[model samples]
Target: MRRDLASNIADVPAIAPAVQSAAADGAAIDTKGFSSLAFLVNTGAIVGSGDFGVKLQESDSSGSGFTDVAADQVDTTAPATLTATSSYKLGYRGNKRFVRLALAKTGGTSIALGAIAVLGHPDHAPVA
Candidate 1:
């Protein structure tokens, strides 16, 4: 059922602090009860010789085990490269209990970037 936008304001789901990419790859995120998620990524500090890639990942287990979710990612034509400051959005709806963003960088020491994910549960009913 479609809900009125105003009524859902208080229940709006959001990820805590925006996720920032580190110098190296990080671990998976836990999404036990959320049925949906939207990730927003902002990139910066890219040099001509640096490259970066971000992919949406999911896993049934809550641990480090994770695999890429087919077809759900940013940069459709070419893998994400930090040629300039840019913003990208990606969404996921799956049966897995855990989800996360995977970051990969090459030819550079770092790529300045941050991401935030908003999660939703269809069964979440708002209080009157």
Candidate 2:
């Protein structure tokens, strides 16, 4: 059995952890060498009341031209309306080569939130 997960999977910084009040558009992640992806959204000490909607955007190219991924391609539908200090895991089953996180903060104070994209099922082991 292989126990070295660090060498077998690749990770990309989807969003930087920080206290933000406005909507955030996370960095784009390329999914070319991977087949599976899971997104982790973390929040700490929300100050106001509003739905911090979370959604996935995709594009053939990582630089520009992005659109919202189909709802069916994502695992969760109601995880968008989050307003507390918690963490959520979202799975992406879409076929898009590039994906990113778009956070919509509606009428909320500065919320500390961050996100990461965990790549799995790489085409080759020991992802680099």
Candidate 3:
């Protein structure tokens, strides 16, 4: 049997919890030593009605050119109706070296949320 322990993974902040009323880009996670990544989203308050989606972007450079990852590449799609005080996630399996998550919003008040990037399957063990 095999198991993936904490030592095998690296956790990075994708975004911090805030009252977000506008579109924002999350942290650009570098996947040099790791081979896999996942974005975990925590949402709070539903003051806004249609802030239910986040786009996964990737690029060769960490600073720019982060366009949305293809729909088929992501493991999960954020629900159409986002619930208050709930959690969501999206997995990354593309070949890009850098990746990030961008919150998508339209004509709304504010939604409190944040995210974290979990990187796993390191090229070498112990993910230091």
User: What are the Cα lDDT values of the candidates?
Assistant: 0.57, 0.83, 0.85
User: What's model 2's lDDT at 5?
Assistant: 90
After superposition of all CA atoms, the RMSD between model 2 and the true structure is 1.8
Evaluate residue 12 in candidate 2 and report its C-alpha lDDT on the 0 to 100 scale: 83
Ranking by TM-score: 3, 2, 1
Per-residue lDDT of 44-125 in model 2, one digit per residue for the tens? 7777665577888999998999999898898863365775788887788888899998888777677788889999988888
Each model's TM-score, in the order given?
0.66, 0.90, 0.91
* CA deviation > 4 Å runs, candidate 1: 1-27, 72-79, 125-128
The order of the candidates by lDDT, greatest first, is 3, 2, 1
lDDT, candidate 1, 7-80, per-residue tens = 33222222223323443333455554455566666666765456677777778886766887878443233245
Candidate 3 residue pairs in clash (backbone atoms < 3 Å): none
Least lDDT summed over 10 consecutive residues: which range in candidate 1?
8-17
Clashes (N, CA, C under 3 Å) per candidate: 0, 0, 0
lDDT of 1 at 64: 66
